[model samples]
Target chain A: MRLFRSTLTALALALPLAAPTLGLATSAHAAPYTIDNSHTSVLFKTTHLGVSPFWGRFNNVTGSFQYDAAKVDASKVQFEIDVNSVFTADKKRDDHLKSPDFFSAKQFPKITFESTSVKAGKAAGSLSVTGTLTVRGTKKTITVELAKTGEGKDPWGGERIGFEGSFVINRLDYGVSYMPEGLGKDVTIVVAVEGIKG
Target chain B: MDPILALAFGVVVPALVALAFVVVLRRPFARTARGGETDLPAPWAAGFGLAAAYGIGVGLLLGWPDLPPVDVTLVAPWAAGVAAFLGLIRDGRVRGAASGVLGLGLGVFMTGPIEDMTLRVGLIAGVTASMVALERGLARLSERLDPRGAALSQIVLVSGAALAVLFSDTASLAQATGGLAAGLGALFTLGLLWPRAAVLTRAAPAVAAILVTNLWGTTLFANGHPAVLAALTLAPLLVSFIPPLAASRRAILRIAVPAALIGIPIAAAGAFAGLRYFATEDASASEHATGPTDPTSPSAATPATPSGTPTTSGTPTTPGTSGYDPGYGY
Candidate 1:
């Protein structure tokens, strides 16, 4: 009876000592990352006249992410793209894209995405993120399959992580239904982001 | 811009539909008025047709607007519907009040949700006054200019507005205006084909409402130049400047003089728009040649202001080896 009591006393002492270590291990997996705008790019390609793919991009993107490599489903991400930042080389076309016919930048300034769910993707180090995407006041759920490009420390002593994802969406579904025949409905969007550990 | 699509959807189809609707409804509409007066006293029979046909063209060209519209583009069809409804009332005072209400509502709605209270109130008063005045002005013009002259004036005004809006870098609104011009063209063409059926009394209120609201909408929502749109608003008034036409004067001069008078402001507006467009293009080219001085500057993030000029200096990456063309196909 005396030995049993002694062992019980030892077990209580160890539990308290190990609790902080377990907490640290859990917190290590949940890291915050701020998007590095200079290195990040949000590119899109839409078919022009049904003949070829026309490429364009948004220059201003800002967002952050919470990543848990150990539990992919626990990761969450959000991004805001300035609709006015749409760049298509041709100023006239860019203006049209920002007008009421497409993004309506003056009325709906920001195109945003916030992840609702995340799941393990088919490939290793990849995640399938489902999010509510808002464009021109219309909100729709869209899924993006993202592959981890790399994770490392930069020369400046900042920890960095990168991801690349591609997805297809119907512009018409988002109420950008101008020129139904001249411009293709389906647009392929590519997002490549580099984040600094915050 | 797809010229073929714009021509087909914005011009041809709407024109045909409007022409048919005007021609088919003439006798039936006249019968309704026969019991009351020598002609149709009801104002909406033809107005509704024009508004409906224009709405259809806007739908085909730029998809029908969403419920509880957020922008002018979405509100355009609804405004047309409201204008057509206003045409149904035979009482001039009541119609005028209703038109005033509509204009006030549009002035508040089309400016988007962020306009300050003072600006909103000013817009409301301006729009209300303009709507009442234009309705009365159109009524007088219809009586004095006759049906053909009135229709031609509408065509010129809307067409000029379309071209000016186009150069403002808002193609969808321009296309919508183009559709309206085509609908008016159909009305003018019907008068030529069947002189006995040429009746525009019913179409006056709707035409006035659509013209004023569209001009205001383009100027406020779509980056259209205020001066240019204002000139368009006053172009029709120029017809009033031409003294009463003598019966001995050439019959063709009735249409020709009014058309020429109204064309002045439109031509000037178009010229101004062209110069502005080219100036912007030149500035853009120079910026591209110089290239961006700083990749990470805030200037890189900021886009063009709502002055109908895009000043960003993004150098497009060349599509290499794939033979892909990102440049203008036309």
Candidate 2:
């Protein structure tokens, strides 16, 4: 009886370690990433004064996202933008725009985008990310078409992933409808992101 | 100085001058008091005095910034003209709701693109005639109502006027004048219908006037000359004083004394700053367009003769002579 009790105690001690090993073998492979903003940019363009296209870009944007090709269902993506970092290069115009008549940056300082549903693409294929985009204290759901630009090993042996994405949004739809009707309604936003594996 | 900073100075200085006027000139202007003397609390008096001063300062700054040296020639007359119109309407000398309607009609007529003064006057006269007929019809309706009901109607009318001013793109001088006319019309209609509710009736017009005046000031600053801008700022302060001046000896002193003291300096300083800045900017732009010439260069030695004149030796070539080419010297 004493010998049988000793064997049972040893089996109980080894069970916890064995359980993790089993779990590890089947756990989804997701690479954690930090966005490299120096190499990435978010640019947008819209018609101004009804006849001319005016281009603008957000300078300070940072976010983290994770991708698991093997387990497409487990991927997640998120992004945050500093709204005050808007640069049109015209001081008077920019100041007026930042006031309550336009962006009201005092009330809403940050814009954020978070992916609720992400479908992983096959190698060199396109991925679909459905996310919630919040701007000027308003939230809207948007589905973005993201094309994977492939992954490669950096000189420092760090893994890197790149993506190119484009989306269309109406400025008036977000309460920016004070234009005099000649300006274009649709704004095109393009995103290029490069991330390093953590 | 930064334009905005100068503008701030302009706004503050005229207010101070207006306040001084009320304090120092109140006793002498006792006969001009329009509103009866029910003494206001010191704080309220001071607050309103400051507000009035600020309005005057803003007007003067908009019109002429440099006091003593550079007189505000244009804005003073504009402000005086508005004050005179308001006074005429208030004194009952103009007589009846018809005058108010006529004024509004005239204002509307002025808003048209007519460049001819004679034709514009005819249009105004025509519109005024129709407006008088309409106001007379409304007077009949007001006469049938109880005092409370009449007051309520006036409130609604005044509220409507306020709403119109707030929502409409009435940035033009004509629209501003029209808004004032509408406000005054509502006030007069209330006074005729409910004499006892005169105090309450005055509330809407006062608020509307303040708002409309400020709106005018803002728009003028955005579009008009500095002198016009200054006058727009000062107009409201002067108008607000009319009621207080007429009511009581104490009120007259309260309104007049501060206005003179505060309004003058503030308006003067702001106008000076605004004009100075504009002049500096204009001068700099002109200088930049005409680039610096090198004394040793052949272009500098060549004479720039007038359009019909023959070119002479050693005359420096004017920018205009070289097709106004920006790169000619460089």
Candidate 3:
């Protein structure tokens, strides 16, 4: 009976280890969250002709991102921006821009941005996104600054995470240097994204 | 009329004239003819007549003699005309009215200056591609309707306008013209050279126009001397003659005499202006203005705003963060 008790005790101890292994396997199947474009924004501002400041916003941004605070290394992010959906509240100018001399929407239908490396934290860790930005049949790599805004549960019981970041890109770097010299070269992009658990 | 509006009219009218020449004159004349062992004189005559009509229309509509000394708006149509001409010449037919429509559309869209490079580049590329595609598709349709003449007139009109706009100093103009030129050049230079070789004839003149207009525009923008403008204008014309020299000795003389005639005055003028601008002490106050800060440097983060709110919400807000403004926008 004592030998039987020892065997039972050993079995009980082994169960804890087995339980953790099963738990890890189950956690690995955790579903990822995707960016909710309706709830997210990518906004930016730059001086117009080096004089008055102008602000603009981009809509219809869609992407998928996987984030785990515990396993920060496993986090992944991917996104694409609709180049045609740019808005600055000026319809005439916007329409003009939608034509050639800007986006050339007919040849390059989309301007996509994809992440290369993602680092999640408040600490200053460098994050890089390498993606093809197609403009007028020309595609080029553009790297942007990225940061984790925070994650939490919405009132509806869905998990949500936010990210806010910005980066500077040269218009000429991608072969868009057609402007008077007095105009600026660098374009600053601001991103504020909110992802919901899918 | 408002100065800007008047300027726009000056640009648009000439462009329209060039368009009318392609659609009404070039297309109709080419349709009633066929290629033969002997060159077709009637169609060729009509093409020359159309060219004359375009020049006269531009001169009349722009009030050429009375136009302002520094009319920046004329740049757009001139560029578009060049593009359209190249298109018509290359395609060997008139492509519907797509080139004119695209040229005008580009002109309208490219007038604004956006501070964002990505957006700006995105905008330019998108519009140019769309216009070129539209021209090609329309040309194809026109060919289906009228095959014999459609190829010549359509290619010429589209390529001319495209080249004009792509090479123009204005962003829209340059985009349209350059996109068309590159597109047609690639199409023809590739094994697709048979029907499209005629487009090169149109391209020659378009190139000449581009070189001259660019030089003139640059000179005027800089307020340089006429001699400098003349010299800059002649350089491209002179360079174009090199390719033809290998083809025929007669072709060499044909290109050389005119090139030299135009080139001498241009070279002399450009040299004189270069000497004058560099030697003179009267630098314009506009030249003294400080330029925009380089946005590439980490230290050049946008300065904080005194309003306590970040200048750019959710992004770095620094003084000059938006870059330099030309003070044109209200």
Candidate 4:
């Protein structure tokens, strides 16, 4: 009976030590992280009249990500952006962006992204996330290079991970083609987000 | 293409194409109407030309729009097509009612999937009523006015609305509307050159449809002023009620009087739009006025998707994606 009890104690101690190894072995394993809305920003810029660069951002964005620093290839992220949340610091121009001529926010109210595949980059803590981006009811597959900013425990005892990514898309490809001359068709989208572990 | 060149391509080419179509089809269309082989009472050549021209212009500017159109802007060509088809119905009452239904559908489509039920219903109802009333008024005016007079009035009204919608801040929409005015101006010229062949009888439904749809589209979707839209809408109907002038027997007087009457409201709407535009510009001056926030401006530099080199080539390929030069690095 003593021998069996000793084995049980030994197994219990081994299990705790083996847990992290098991996690590392499973390449598909991931943890869900809710996007920290307060710390997230989705921004874009285009040229105006082919003369100067113009910038704007979406204010209301919500999404969650499945991430594992060890298994970045298995990571998946998705975002839902409220189209009406588009802001350019100018109300009239913003309104124009929301109109049918541009985003057509009324007809297609949300711009969404769902990562299809994630590949680790050559650099440490860097990844290339390939996803289908749907804007104004049109979908296009795009890849964004994401670099890990940091990961740590917050003061409130919560775990957080941050990422910054940038990608270029031709707005015309997604049918947001308005004012072809007045506004540049190619738009660069930069996304930075802090994700909280639940 | 340069912006000036592109603007010209979008405006002038479509107008010329439409004029060519009208000129080419005038003889055949007039014969068919006169023979009563076609159900339509008049040639409707200008209406058909306008619809075709607008479609071609949209194609040149935005690429041929997708089937089951993905945007409200894409719906304009289809709407113009429907208006042209409705112009074919022989019965006046049925045509007017169908125009109202078309307006209802347009309003619903323009408002899109918004959650505001009251606003949706109001837009649908307003568009329906206005289309019906405008169709009736245009039919009456078409009977009394000569072809030149009718075409002149339409050109003036549509051109004015195009300018006003431009003031409202949607350059594409204004450009599309400008194509319509250009076609009408072409039609007016055709009427002057070949009055008998370019008869505008039965063109009321199509003409009214184009006008109402564009005005409502501007007002409902593009934040255009309702009062301005209302004033423009009233202008066409008001022309129908103008009393026969003492010099109505004179050719120039006949066309000028109605065009002048239509001009009154258009001028008023334009004035209102101009004032509103300047006021907004002044109020938002701190926000950098009309243009997009310039990256090099004193304000924070916004991170943008860069398309390295600007291409005058029609294709919209970004740098790195295609062989185009990479724009500013992220």
Candidate 5:
């Protein structure tokens, strides 16, 4: 009778500790963060004809991220870019880019990216994120260098995080082969995004 | 700036210049067939100027990124201009639409617009045959149709096509329409301001046909629907069937009936095109995305401004793949 009572007491004591350990394991994996589009921007620069490079950006971008500082490999990120929000300062140039020649904003309204894998990058505290980027219905796997910018508490005490990265892509590879001779095939994209814990 | 702004100025400037030309030349050349020294109505000069304005002004806008390739729109107007010059030859008349056909054919051949030999030749032959046949039938009934009435009809039809082009985000093509509108407007203004000096020539429809068919080719080349151009061309010919009246009320009836015939269908086509464009535009879809900004849905990021207005950022390129030509297999 005493042996049975002692075993039950031991199991009851371990249950509280075990439950916390399981919860901690999940918390360590990653936390969901909503991308604050107002503070995020995507910039791209391309050679005009091997003579000069021009820069442009998408104004409206929204996405979410599953990120953990300790478990970087388990993180995932996704983004949706409003293709019609392409702005290059000059309205005429923006129109040309939005046209069927480059992005075909009407045919493909969104440029999207979803991460499939991530690993430690070359730089310290940086991650190499591999994702499928879809533009104009054509998708290709691209790797972007995602460096952790910072994390802190906002004025409202909400947790905020940020990332800054860049990568190069071929427009032709994305099926944007209009005036190939007039515009360089390769385009360089830069990204800076902030995430607010929801 | 909106492309409409550029297109508008492209027209206003040339129209002012053409008007000035008419006024300047009026003192020297204004005369009637009845042998009176009146202000001149230079149909040939006005027609040539009108064609030139649409050709050069709109061509520059359309060919910005297209490099040094010849386009049919670039040449067809000049051919019509040549036909208009024939109108100056003191009765060196081109029967019906023959002048326009010859001009467009020569224009297509000399320029060698597309690399595809079969397509280029086919367009040239088809447009020429269709246009010439239509104009010839109308020319046989020219006695009942007045020149002013015909000129007015051309303006109404071209304006309809222009509105449709504008809605399709085709700035350059829209500019071409703007130029044609300006030309016809110049002719009408001159007719109204100096009635005796107005030179409404018999060759106006044929000359105008070149512009219409060029637009027909352009719109079909860009967008598959050529009904706007087809409707534009057909309505004017319907005006020719208006009966000739020898009564005192002949002047108003002759002008009014033909205009009404041409204007109604053109209006219908323009309105339909506009409705269809707005229906399919991405902005409309975005507008309905008015629910809560769900963090789960990435599309919620779309800005409200683009949905409500004709944004400059989303306009398409000129002619795009519609102008794509694989080299001839010759």
Candidate 6:
């Protein structure tokens, strides 16, 4: 009985030591990180009349990402942007855009991006996330360059990860061809995401 | 091919078809009406030419594999075809004001397939009201005009509208309706003046009415605040009243007066087509407007998803936020 008790105590002690090895063994497993809205910014800019640059951002953005630092290729991201949340700061223009001429947000409420593949880019600490970006019911495959800025614990004791990505996409590809002169066709999207470790 | 060449190719099919129609069927329908003989080919020839060119011809070119890149929709051709077909029916058999009402209904509903049906309805209704007012004005100044002047003036007016549309935002619409309007306008201009063809020009107004509706209906901004097109529709009719006031029969004055009158509206439409653009949203003062933010600005963040999954948005504004330019509803 005493030997069994001793074995139980040693086993319990060893388990904690082995727990880190278990974590290392499963290091290939992805960490599911929820996007931290308070620290995230999603922005896009396009040329005005094909000359000067203009900017717009989606007010309501939601998405989660599965990231494996060791297996960088396995990291994946998906975003669902509320297209109706488009805020250009011009009410008339916003109404016009929300109308059929542009986004048709009522018909297509959400713009989605789901990663298809991930590859470590040639640049250090960067990943090329190729994904299908759907807008206004049209989908196109695009590669967004996501660079890791840093990862650490916060003062609130919450573990968090940081990343920023950018890509240029043609609005025409998604059939938002209204007012071509008023609104440029090529939109540059820059997303900064601070994901909290779950 | 060059633009001129494209225009040539685009119009060639309808022109040939029209030539064949006028040349081949001249004798049978060349028979005089009860009133007298005329120079215009039968009414069917003009209708066929307009429909064939703007309708089927435009359709062919638009569908062709190798054309220069252009961004446009087929709404113009489709609307023009319905107008031409209906106008032909009204001219051919379904006579009177009821037919005009029916044509207007058909024309407005045809725009249902397009975006912003409400805006389209406004354009058609405004054009209708403007045309009606012009007709009443012409009635008050009957001594100055004859059927030939009225018909030709309408032809000129519609042709101008088509020109405006051609020069406007959409290229495909320009080619399609422009080519066809030119053909019909030329046919009417020649035929109405020709003594033997006057019978063929008998119902040109009815034809122009429906055809003109398509010209505006297919446009992106068919109805703007100044209502330029409504003004264009009224210009020729208003000009017709001027000559009697001057009490002059002088041909140069007659020609110059009408030319100047028509030029004003044409220029207006052209300016909107070429110069006007919706002011970008960025022009309005916004608390967030810190001079166009860079696409790669790292201050972005998205909030958490409803599913409890974390999301990111940088400098995040609360959801359902609002701020925008209130200067214009247009």
Instruction: Please tell me which predicted candidate would have the highest lDDT against the true structure.
Output: 4
Task: Sort candidate 1 into its docking category.
Answer: acceptable
Worst lDDT run of 10 residues, candidate 6 chain A, spans: A91-100
User: Mind giving the per-residue lDDT tens digits that candidate 6 earns over A80-145?
Assistant: 887766777654455455543466554466889999998897689888999999987678999988
DockQ of 4: 0.19
Runs with alpha carbons beyond 4 Å of true place in candidate 6: A1-198, B4-6, B9-40, B56-74, B90-177, B185-223, B236-330
**Ranking of predictions according to lDDT:** 4, 1, 5, 6, 2, 3
In lDDT terms, how accurate is model 5?
0.61
B240 Cα displacement, candidate 2 (Å): 4.6
The digit string of per-residue lDDT tens for model 1 on B117-194 reads: 888787777767767666665555565675677777777877887888777667777788788788878777767765
The TM-scores, one per candidate, come to: 0.83, 0.43, 0.40, 0.81, 0.50, 0.49
- Fnat of all models, as shown: 0.21, 0.00, 0.05, 0.33, 0.00, 0.14
- Please, what are the lDDT tens digits per residue for candidate 3 over residues A14-70? 886787567663346434888887667777666666776677766667788766665
User: Candidate 1 lDDT, tens digit per residue, A132-195?
Assistant: 9998888999999999999999988999999999999998778887776778989899999999
What is model 6's native contact fraction?
A: 0.14
Sort the predicted structures by DockQ, highest score first: 1, 4, 6, 3, 5, 2
Off by over 4 Å in 4: A1-29, A49-52, B35-42, B245-247, B286-330
Q: After superposition, how far is residue B32 of candidate 5 from its true place, in Å?
A: 9.5
Top model by DockQ, which number? 1
Model 6, span B1-330: residue lDDT tens: 245556575666655654555445455655652235443355545545555555555545444211221112334444333443443442323333433454465445444444676876775565555434433332222224443344345445555665555443334445555565555445545544552332223233334443444444434332222455556656655675565533447644543454456566766765664443222222223223442222223321111224743333223233433322222122
| Candidate achieving higher DockQ, 3 or 5 | 3
Tell me how much of the true interface, by contacts, candidate 2 captures: 0.00
What lDDT would each prediction earn against the true structure?
A: 0.73, 0.45, 0.43, 0.74, 0.61, 0.55
Error of 6 at B209 (Å): 7.3
TM-score of 6: 0.49
* Model 1 stretches astray by more than 4 angstroms: A1-29, B1-6, B27-29, B36-42, B193-198, B241-249, B292-330
lDDT tens digits, residues A100-190, model 2? Answer: 3345454455678999988864435677888898875567899888888879998888899998998998865554433324446688889
